[model samples]
Target: QRLLVTIALEAARVMEEGIVTDPREADVGSILAFGFAPYTGGALSYIDGIGAKLFVKIAKGLQKKYGAEFKAPKLLLDMAEKGETFYERFDPY
Candidate 1:
């Protein structure tokens, strides 16, 4: 479960910051391209459910264990600092 969350959130961070512009697209790609489990509500939702600040902290810990690949991007850190979820911060409309 931890691995699943980590990979999913990391992919979300990647997409949110660069690969994709909208949260919906990111979530859709995770579901369509990777067949991610829908119960978690996609990767960004998983992080949002965990709280962005907590997610960053968890990602930092994961980065310690898994090297820099698990590092959260600056955008995530900023959003976390503001207590904003991905949907709230980057809503697709």
Candidate 2:
């Protein structure tokens, strides 16, 4: 679970930094290139499935226990605060 949170948040951070514009591209790249957990449907999808608000809470706990590396990205925090999901916000469809 912690690992999942880390992956999701890190991916979110990458996006937040403008390293990737399309969430779908990032998701597909991670799955195809890095062999990320396919069952979770890639990192962003996993976060979306988990719900941004809940994922932020989990990430905050992990961040407190772990370190700044586990800190939730500003994009994710904003999403959580706005009650937005990746799919709903990015809307690949």
Candidate 3:
């Protein structure tokens, strides 16, 4: 879970910096460049597969039990709240 959050946040940060165009590209890069799990369809997909809302909820609990690093980002929270999926928003076919 920590690994998932770390990868998702890192990918988001890179995208926010305008270093990447889409989440899929970022996922691919992270997988190939950083050796992320391809079987899980990269980090973003892994998060999606786990369900962002559930991930954020678990992350929040983990944050309280652990540290701030476990806290989900505002972007993720907002995305989850609106039922807006990361892949749909970031990639959009």
- Greater lDDT among 1 and 2 belongs to 2
Tell me the lDDT of model 2 at 17. Answer: 88
Write out the backbone clash pairs for model 1. none
Global lDDT scores for all candidate models: 0.76, 0.83, 0.74
The parts of candidate 2 lying over 4 Å away from their true place are none
Which is the winner by lDDT between candidate 1 and candidate 3? 1
Q: Provide the lDDT at 58 for model 1.
A: 84
The lDDT, on a scale of 0 to 1, for candidate 2 is 0.83
lDDT tens digits by residue: candidate 3, 1-93: 567667776776566567876878888987998777788787777667777787778778878987887767777778778776668778747
Top candidate, metric TM-score: 2
User: Alpha-carbon error at 48 in model 1, in Å?
Assistant: 1.2
TM-score-based ranking: 2, 1, 3
lDDT of 2 by residue, 1-86 (tens): 87777677778988888888788987887788767799888989888888888988888898898888888878998999999987
Worst 10 residues of 2 by lDDT: 1-10
User: Which predicted model would earn the best lDDT?
Assistant: 2
